[model samples]
Target: MSDTVLDEWQIALKQKKTELEKCQKEHHVESCLKCEKLLNCEMRETYVKAVYDSMSKGKGGGFEF
Candidate 1:
């Protein structure tokens, strides 16, 4: 078992990436959607937004993990 503990940002980023894959269907992120905490998920709205912002700024699109 790996002991790697991902920080809040990393976790949020990973979740967003996964969600994006199913919802957005993109490895990277061209456009980010609002979370609004409607789902009452662990990832906060601000954190999700931050990840979305980072994904949008990435060079090109569809950044595979």
Candidate 2:
């Protein structure tokens, strides 16, 4: 994939992570349920892992396998 695409995906993943965190913090179980379900979804994880893997290859982002 192109760097621009990868960057966009990375930004999206970060946005999703932030949304999930907000839902969890606000005690929005329903929101969190949706977020958790998405996070656990195969496609979502794939994207997340791709971004994490790329970041991990750089200055060591501390992502656990």
Candidate 3:
């Protein structure tokens, strides 16, 4: 959270819908263990946390369980 530029994952979070969908389509990010884009992506943890947090808080989505 500084003046430094945001990384790919941070940028993705800001564009959550498109970014997540694109990753899913291209890499099957959640299901693909051998995902190339995700294998070395530095934003992996932040991306996952952002997704789960969004679901639980109903910020961008919802979850029943």
When summed lDDT is taken over every stretch of 10 residues in candidate 3, the lowest stretch is 54-63
Provide TM-scores for the models: 0.36, 0.36, 0.32
* Winner by lDDT: 3
Better of 2 and 3 by TM-score: 2
For residues 1-65, write the lDDT of model 3, one tens digit per residue.
Answer: 57888655555567765565566677656643557766666455556666676545534564676
Which pairs clash (backbone N, Cα, C closer than 3 Å) in model 2?
Answer: none
lDDT by residue (tens digit), candidate 2, 13-58: 6776776566556655554445656545654555556567557544
| Candidate 2 structure lDDT | 0.58
Model 3 accuracy (lDDT, Cα): 0.60
lDDT of each: 0.55, 0.58, 0.60
> What would the per-residue lDDT of candidate 1 be over residues 1-65, giving only the tens digit for each residue?
97998766567677766665554333243444453433664434545675755666433355467
Residue range with the least summed lDDT across 10 consecutive positions in model 1:
24-33
